[model samples]
Every structure is written in structure tokens, then in C-alpha cells.
Target: MAHFDSNFIMSRILLTDEPTQIGCVYLEAGGIIGFHQALSAQLLLVVHGPASVRCDSESEVCVSVGDAVFWEKGEWHETKTETGLMAIVIESEALNPTKYMPVKLIKD
Candidate 1:
């Protein structure tokens, strides 16, 4: 957790395994997580008040409690909030080929 001012605090929790990852981030009002890209398919869940997101190929979107967003692997995205925001983030697969076996599309 980090305290930025009298009214703002940021916190995060993260976990991962070979196939997936789960994380939660708490961002206070006006806080930003910055522009970035996901290495694998991702699911972002907004579990608290208003947050906004910007992703490549789309316009910015405002999200609230119970809202969810999905991002394809390697898609650039960013997140911010004008009010306190709690987001649950999940990513699927290892992403890095060096870390896992090759995927087989079919069985002979």
C-alpha cells in the first residue's frame, strides 16, 4: 500500500501460476496505473466506483461496479480513476513461449 495524500491510497495484491494470474489493485481518486500492454489475454473487473480505461483500437470507457473488460494478448491498455477504484485483473496463459511448451492445435 502507498499513501499519496491525505485522501488517497493505493494498494495491490497479485498471484500467478503457469496458466493464469489474478490480481487486485486499489486506486484512490485521480490515481493512475499508466499506459501498458498485457502479454496475454486479460480480464479486468471493476469491483468498485468509477474508473476509466483506454485501449488500442477503441475509445476510452468509463466503468463501474460489476463492469468487466477484456483485452487480447499484447494489446496496449491503460487505467485511471476519478473516484476510488478497485479492479480485479486476470491474465491467462504463460505468455512467454520460453516458459511453457508449445501449444498444439490438434491431435493426430
Candidate 2:
């Protein structure tokens, strides 16, 4: 068995604009976010420590506190941690949520 700190919790709140959702996340050393897609153009800023980010067709880059990065809609990317990382992120609900429809799942 393996013990993982699993720093995956994120705090998100809809902005006054209502169409924008802002959030923050903290990742301890060794944390990783596997490849994923962004439904809306997303912006992220490193609040503290260092963050490693890689976008589709691009080499990974290390961004320090105060650095900002953007990913276009539908872009594939991934983030990993070499050290602790803290970041703020924003995504537009108008673009992503408007098309979201939950599918029903039958379970026992």
C-alpha cells in the first residue's frame, strides 16, 4: 500500500461576473496532474513555489511565483510538482459550463 498526501483539493468560486470561475490550488512536493483538456481559454498564475506546466506540442516549462500562463480552449496540458506549488486559476463558465450536460448513471 502507498500513502499519498493527494493534494488535489481546490477552492473555486464564481466571480461577480457569474460567467467566470476562479480558484486556487495547493500542491505539496511530488504532486502531479495528469494530462487534461481545457474547455475554455484558461489562465493560471503561480502564487508561490514552483510549477511545471506543459501544453500540447510544447516543451515543459517551470514557472515561479508571479508567473502566468494561458491555455487556449481544448488545449491539452499537464502539471507536475518538483517542489510545493500554489496557484490561482480562472476559467470561463460561459464557454465551458453552457454546454455541460450530466449523463444519468444507474447503480446499485
Candidate 3:
């Protein structure tokens, strides 16, 4: 519970035993993070701007602020943007977003 006047919110805890890393990435206009296989399970959370992401041979998907993309270990993926963007990336062998995040269904 949060106090009405506190302006503070608590987040659910995530536990991991394997090595974990978190990073903030910025992409300029026309920037791209080329395709590569994920070394571990990974999650990319967009915090600003918009970008496109692709996994394996799948078509690119546009993502904007507040969108999140996850990739399993060994999955090939790529990220790019035309108008720049900023995102938080989390990597770990033990990452499991399904435990804390609701699945977002996409129709082909």
C-alpha cells in the first residue's frame, strides 16, 4: 500500500541466482543494434521514444515508450530506431518476465 501524500510506489521483487546485468541504452536517429544472439534471457524496456525490434526471422515490430520486449537465451534479435530512443536492458540466465508481467498478445 502507498500513502496518499507520499508520492512513492513499491515494486514487486524479482529474485535471481545467476549473474545479472542491467544497462541503459540510447539510440540516435537512424541508429541500430544489429542482429545477434542473446547470451542469456534478456528484456528490453522502452522508456523514451520509439523503435523497431525483430526476433529471429520474424518481421520487425514497432515499440514505443512503456513497451517491453523479451528474448530467450540464444534467440537472435535486433533493435533500431529512426527517431532515437532510450531503453533499459536486463540480462540474466534466470530471468522470467511471465512471473511478474502480463503477456501482451499480438495478432499476425
Candidate 4:
């Protein structure tokens, strides 16, 4: 078992490669994380701030602090930031979440 910390701020905690092949996310603040189609189901634990997730033609949902959201795989979604957003993403086949919790998730 390994512990990974956020390089950006000290508000986030992470657990990698537990249930699935990937890790789970715990956000401490709010920020913008790009958009893309997921290959796994993302378990979003919003400890603070509000997050807006939009995929395809689906309406955006405002997730506040203490809210837990699950984003399935193969859906195009983008993180909307107004006042910084903190949310975790679950990698489907990811054996570790901490190792994948970076800007690398957002493909360019």
C-alpha cells in the first residue's frame, strides 16, 4: 500500500488500486480538469466546492461539497470550474488511483 499526495495543493487525499484496477479520488478544493471520454467508471468524492459535469447532450449537474458522484465509462465529460473544483476520478482498469491522479489524465 502506497500513499500519494497532490502536487498542486495539500487539500486532496488519494487511494490507489483498491477495488478495481485503478484508484479512487478525494478532492480538497476546486479546480479545472479538462474533458474526455472515460474508459472506466469514475467515483468522484467532492469534499469541497461545486462541480459541473457535462457529457454529450446530457444536462450538467451541480455537485456540492460532501457529494459523491459516479461517472461511468465511455462518456465525454468536462470539468467546469468557476471557483476551483476538487473531485476524484476512478480509473476502470487502474490498479492505482494515486499514480493516475495528475494532468496526465487529461489527454492533449
Candidate 5:
């Protein structure tokens, strides 16, 4: 087990406004979240295992633990896993991940 020097660590606040929803999602093997438009800005953070994600007509991209995928409101997207996975999904009109995380550029 790892240990921290301090007994307590201060946490920085990110969002102040109430978000539409924040929830955990579990995708079973061979499961798929069908293609659909995002009603609000959405962020999906993979917490366990691996999965594939696609936005609009782009090619599907593989994502594993610690990967974060963001989709803007009204954008078409889909997610699926062949071996099951768990993720945290955050949806909000005020969501802005760029402010806190660096962008991951994908080479064509």
C-alpha cells in the first residue's frame, strides 16, 4: 500500500454549478451503447478494463483505464466493449474538460 505524508489532502474545486447528471456505467462483454446524439456535453472516463469509442463518422478508437472521452452537445457518438468495462459518465451543459485536462491528439 502507498502512503501520503499528510493525513489529509486539499481538494480543488472544479465545477460550481449543478451538473445535469453524473453516474457510473457498466458495459458487459459484447455490449454496445448505440449511436446517438449527445443531449448535453458529455465525458466518459474509463475506470476499468477496455472499450471502444467513436464519434460521428470517425473510426472507432480503443480506450482503456484512465482514458477520457469527451463529446460535445448534439454530437453523435457510441461506446462498446468486447470484454466488459466500467466508466464514469458526466453530462452537463457547463462541462468543460479542456480547462482541467490536456487534449489527446489522434494521428490519422
Candidate 6:
């Protein structure tokens, strides 16, 4: 079973096996870092301040402290800071092959 606890500091917790990883990330004020395409679907859960997300051809969505968003694989996307945002990002397997492997979030 996978588990996590972010009551102390901003952190991340990775769960599940290959091709199906769940993550929980915490961010402080104006903290953001993600512009790469994923090999799988991503589900984001906001736990703190307001967060903004932009997708190809789609208007940015401002998620409140208790909102969630779903992103498809291979869809170029970027997240920005608005108000100290904290979230949980989960990824699923890719539909096609020959893409980034390890099927995991951890790159080695």
C-alpha cells in the first residue's frame, strides 16, 4: 500500500507501481516547476491557494483551494503560481509506446 503525510513541509509522495503512479506535491508561494509532457494521464488535486493551469488551445483554469483537474497524456501543459498552491498529481499509463519509459515519475 502507498502512503503519504505532508503536514510538516512541502513534499511529494509517489505511490503505486510502473505505468500507474500517484503523486502528492506541495508548493509554496510563487512556486512552480513543470512544463514537460507526460506519458500518461495526470489528475491534479489542489489543497491550498488558488492555482492556474494552461493547456493547448484551452483557456486557463483557475482552481481554488479545493478543486481538481484532469489532463491528458501528450498534451503540452504548464502550471503557474497565483497564490501559494499545493497539489497532488497522479499519472496513469500511456496509450502508445516508444515514449518515455520506466513508466514512472522517477527518472534514473
Best by lDDT: 3
lDDT of 1 by residue, 1-108 (tens): 346546764332223466787799899999998888888877777888898888875667777896766677888999899878998887886433223223222112
What TM-score does prediction 4 earn? 0.54
Assess each prediction's global lDDT (C-alpha) against the native: 0.72, 0.71, 0.89, 0.57, 0.86, 0.63
The reply for model 1, stretches above 4 Å from the true place, is 1-18, 94-108
Q: List candidate 6 segments past 4 Å from native.
A: 1-18, 94-108
> Candidate 3: worst 10 consecutive residues by lDDT?
5-14
State TM-scores per candidate. 0.66, 0.67, 0.89, 0.54, 0.85, 0.62
lDDT of 3 at 72: 94
Error of 3 at 1 (Å): 4.0
For candidate 2, which ten residues in a row score worst on lDDT? Answer: 97-106
Q: Which clashing pairs does model 3 show?
A: none
- Model 4 lDDT on a 0 to 1 scale: 0.57
lDDT of 3 by residue, 47-74 (tens): 9999999998888899999888999999
Give me the displacement of residue 11 in model 6, in angstroms: 24
Root-mean-square deviation (CA) per prediction = 12.7, 15.5, 2.0, 10.9, 3.4, 10.6
How many Å off is the CA of 69 in candidate 2? 0.6
lDDT per residue for candidate 2 within 1-108, as digits (tens), equals 234856564433233454776789888999887789997877676888987888876778877886666677898988888888888887874433223323222222
- Among all windows of ten consecutive residues in candidate 5, which has the lowest summed lDDT? 5-14
Clashing pairs in 1: none
**Evaluation by lDDT, superior candidate among 1 and 3:** 3
Best by TM-score: 3
